[model samples]
Target chain A: MDLVKVQLTNSEFLSTGIEKLDNLLEGGILKGFTTLILGSPGSSIEILSKQLAVKGKVLYVTTDETEQEVMDAITRFGWKPEHIEFTDIATKYSKSVLSREKKRVSIYEQRSKLKLKELIEIGSSGVMPAVKAQEDFLAIFSNSAKTTSPEKIILNSLDFFLSMYSQEEVLRTLHAAKVANIERAGVLFIIMTKGIHGEVFERKMEGMADCVLELNVIQKGSTFERFLAVKKMRNYAKKIGIARYAIDSDGFVLEMIERIM
Target chain B: MTNSESYVYNQNRIGLNENENAKSSCPCITGIDELDQKLGGGLPSGNTVLLVGSSGSGKTTLSMQFLTNGAKIGERGVFFTITEPLFKLTKNLEKFDFYDKKMIESGMVNLIDLRIISERLGLDAEKYTVEDASALLEILKDIADELDVKRLIIDSITALCYRLQTKEMIRDFIFKLGSSLASMNCTTILTSEVPPNEVKYSQYGIEEFIADGIIFLGDVDRKGDLIRTLQVIKMRGTNHSRTKSAMSISSKNGIELTPLLKSRV
Candidate 1:
């Protein structure tokens, strides 16, 4: 049986900025689709996401990396960082922790000198050391996503939020963002690590997304090879294939795509 | 007598034997003539006065008027704000003719935010510890020394004390701050917030005790209308009238105080 090619205009799709990937994705990611990218350590998922951001107005919600670090990585790869607006959760989280630690130290040093009444007051006031309210990063990300009408949205890694917040909270925010992106006809990319979250949760995440891609690094006697698997493409099963890829000086280079039967 | 007549009578009575008292005690004249007369001349120099009032009772306005008036007399004043943002405070001040932007720019009046100072000093605690309070006191002293400030106002000390959880910390902070600023000869006014109609002059119930003076600001219901009133409950180093006065705030007259006439209402 011969496969017939269907053409989609540029307006109907959001390009991943790689010609080969766009061809493999059938003109690129469909507009309004939420794409989930699952990768393990050494899989170069970061570079892939940054490459996806090269073409559009991007709101990059970075949880595991600071804005400066992300910009430095993007710059080092010769990508333009000017078009990206970052909601940097990593720096905020780190600063909150450091500030809490300093406050704890100061409280400890003054504890012995405080009178019993003073200690009682401190206890009653609920201003004890390290008791500051934690910031709701999910809400922050949701707010930024709602306020800005970006063409592309990228959340680099779900593990940070999953460890900090409940699954329900994370899912609610993700669903809201997905609906907003759908309304704006924009693309949303959520990055998560493979195998860390349970298979059930992983499947739930994949079910939420319109498309799912996975990057795997395999070792054969100390020589590791990287492969990008198009595991799920809702309503477009023909695009399900695997591509062996390398990160060369020019960025993500797709060596070959093996079509799935 | 009519209210206007009493206002004129009080205005005429100002500056009578007040200059002698002011010269002897080195008073920090508030420049509000009636309030200055009520304070014999003005607030005693280097004294920490607790200006206690509820919301919208003119505590902030009175403090700003005091500082701006001091600026007019060639005295530099600094307002360390903890509750309101500096921009919002200045925006509100812009409506008053006494609020001169030139005074702020020329270093005659300084408006500083305590939160910004804490951030700059790397003290990021939401609730300040005793050590943090001590460090804050030092910062205040350093600011006083650096600016050569003659008058200092900490708008709403309640907010600052809220961050300071313990009574001992608040006491130590205020006592030390008072002494340090007093040593520098900086007349300080620390605003304290309390519930309306509450007899207490401060939120913590301890600031009024430590403070050298207490100026209580309140509102009285006069025939279904609320009238702001100011009363000097305690003023050291000079004789002052303890009678409550009717106060009004306006753009033309920043703060006008008239003796509360018994027969007017």
Candidate 2:
């Protein structure tokens, strides 16, 4: 395994699997630091998170996609899903708010399908206070940390909480998450969509995140190009430019298209 | 308070004459004339009506319109809201022009939040235990009787089914609730979410059978886009139109129905 390793104070940095991407972040992302992935709908952050999951234990907290869908994607990417853990908040919200679509009714079935060590479902009982839901999510994460001590935790999106709660509530929850990340020395990936929240809300998150990775899609002629740019990384080797990437059957492949020079 | 005193209170609160209540045989006006026409004249009094639709299909709006219309005519209403909080419901209703501040102040429209009831019963506010459902029924009956409510609306009855954990429990609750509302001579509307691709009108497949009337709201696929439509699937006491009428809803006018859409050959 050509996994690059870097030493950060009080923690170990593991390779992000992509050599060019790892080189940009000075070998890899810090083990205990929180990384924010900012992008729009079409960005391939899901694939990127999956790529990162391959290195070690992953705890994927999904608020957008179903647990099965995430597992299917992992398998498609040539990784065994049994290696990862999932915390599904989206299915519960969908069951409470939306109609009982065929997919939502299958949440129980999906729960049965997961291995005992791989699933934690919050809000399964019913509609809950945003604070309570956040607490439940954090509680499971902490418990999993005790048992498995996941090396990486992925929060699929913050958009769901934005819909269910106030800016202050979500920010407070993120603050707690950041503290946990530091204490556990585990990397946390917070996925978010840009241009959805107000300027102040976005600025607050950008300031709190230890590292911010922005993904943008540019339309040129009849084609669209996707690029990942490292905007900020506190106390780490930071790259100032972008790396173009493409998705194939294997997974996300960083292309040698052009440097953001 | 005595029955006469309660009547005076409700009448003075709505600022309506006593003669309106004397015409008790007249159907409850839903505030939308097209809908009233489809229903042969709104919903039948002393009967329970079911409003079934998918989320975002305006079930809440339609129920609100019904209660507000009853309130306008000095008919007291009790709105038992389950999912949405009272403040959020009030705030959203404020966007509509027909929202009666005077009626609310005078207690012509009473909003009883049922969230606390679930909490008090030591049950999850989203899921329903049999005991909790029984408690809820008693609470509802007490409110309807105490308020002398002529109109009652339980927003999203499907939530109860979602929590109750069994088809028998849901059916039992519906039966008990329907009979209690009828005994009080209350014209009621219970809203529920339509299960996906289900042949039945409601998610549990028993609400339509138990209800006195069923107003099914849905989106119709036209050429490229979807249009809102309302159909009166069943009205037990009245002869209603079976046609699906084109419908539209806005904050200003609430729900408006056009002429029935002609079925193309």
Candidate 3:
């Protein structure tokens, strides 16, 4: 039997949707690398992340917002919502909580109607059986990533996961996701709030990421100024730069990048 | 014929009410004649039987045959598949003449995907905690009760137990599930996977101890041919032949058993 060998033609770089930013990095972000995006509140990182969805098929894992809410924001900036699939963790999380509460209420109502002997038997068991822990959102995210096999993967925030799960668990999942992205030659963009997870944890995340971008918002008098910084680019030291950016009517507009010599 | 009428006709053709064996108090007669004869009737009613086997050894074929046979005799059955999707399983089942799509459609034999059940119950964890196991058991019990399911099959309990971390949890889950189903007079067949050459009947080693019966299915190489075999390791409340029998699966007959011929090689 003759064997047919198939080859995957994946580009070496993926554009961040900004021509100036793409030019500074020679092409764009490297393929098969995890890009960590750090942003303070009101830094317009969400818009920047949404702009990346135009590159290819995107699996937008939204832990911070519902799928509808994210899509609304995307369309508000005239970005096409096509080719983007969402694993809505926020909606699923809320639904899970509501279901758990309902189960608790039902159990309580049943226990209230129980006879003395039955109640005593239950008391002997100490705790009610079949009360499972909260569903593992990390596993769900991982499953979505594997099944979807998107060219561009976006996790809208790590802070929600960190708050829900332990640091070790979150790190393990992040490493697994990173390895999966590398094997598939896909770009993964993970968004997180700056400074909330502490300096040590932040540094560890930066070490894991192949590229790190920080979106900083500064207060100047009563107005706010937004700047996008290419803090770390693996194997490209000369590409480290900072750029003033704003979320204009069209979308995220990069003014200029001052290359850090 | 309409689907309902077709199902009724098929059930009648299979001699539904004529099987005195099914009407017996103790045994739930599987429709396979030779195997039922070997068991002196069939599997014990309300007992949990571990159908342990290696891959492609006719375990699934035999289990489906059991459920379809039960459905023919007015005993409703449900198959909870953990590893395979329902569509894929049904597609595969379409090859067997004993398999009737009408049986599934009529709800006489229910096919459920455990993954769907887990999703519905919000069990997204990689490993099921003890509480998750208990919740799963409760859900299973609810399903059995709701369907009035007389026969239940969990195709490959190995997959289900993979999510259940500890041996203690496995044992507890199986024990409680067995007790609950047995109380409902639901005879269960939990398919278990083992390595081809392993002596153990189950992956976790605790299922065999908890189960009331064991049906071991395996394949042996004899004269350059791999022959599937089935042996009754144990069956509670019945005098069953412990001898191994050669088994063959075909689209025409589903699963057929014959005496194992001694091989000189």
What is each predicted model's overall lDDT from 0 to 1?
Answer: 0.83, 0.73, 0.82
Q: What lDDT score is found at residue A162 in candidate 2?
A: 79
lDDT of 1: 0.83
Instruction: Tell me the docking grade of candidate 2.
Output: incorrect
Model 1 Cα lDDT, one tens digit per residue, B209-257 = 9999999988887788888888999987667889999999998898899
Candidate 1, after superposition: displacement of residue B201 in Å?
0.8
- Tens-digit lDDT string for candidate 2 (A189-224): 888888889878888999999889888888989999
Model 1 regions lying over 4 Å from their true place: A1-96, A99-261, B1-24, B263-265
lDDT of 3 by residue, A126-158 (tens): 232454667899999888988888989999889
Clash-forming residue pairs, model 1: none
Per-residue CA lDDT of model 1 for A74-115, tens digit only, reads 888898754789899999899887775664334333234343
* Candidate 3: Cα lDDT at A135: 85
Instruction: Say what the interface RMSD of candidate 3 is.
Output: 14.1
RMSD of 1: 14.8
What does DockQ give for each predicted structure?
0.02, 0.02, 0.02
TM-score of each: 0.52, 0.48, 0.53
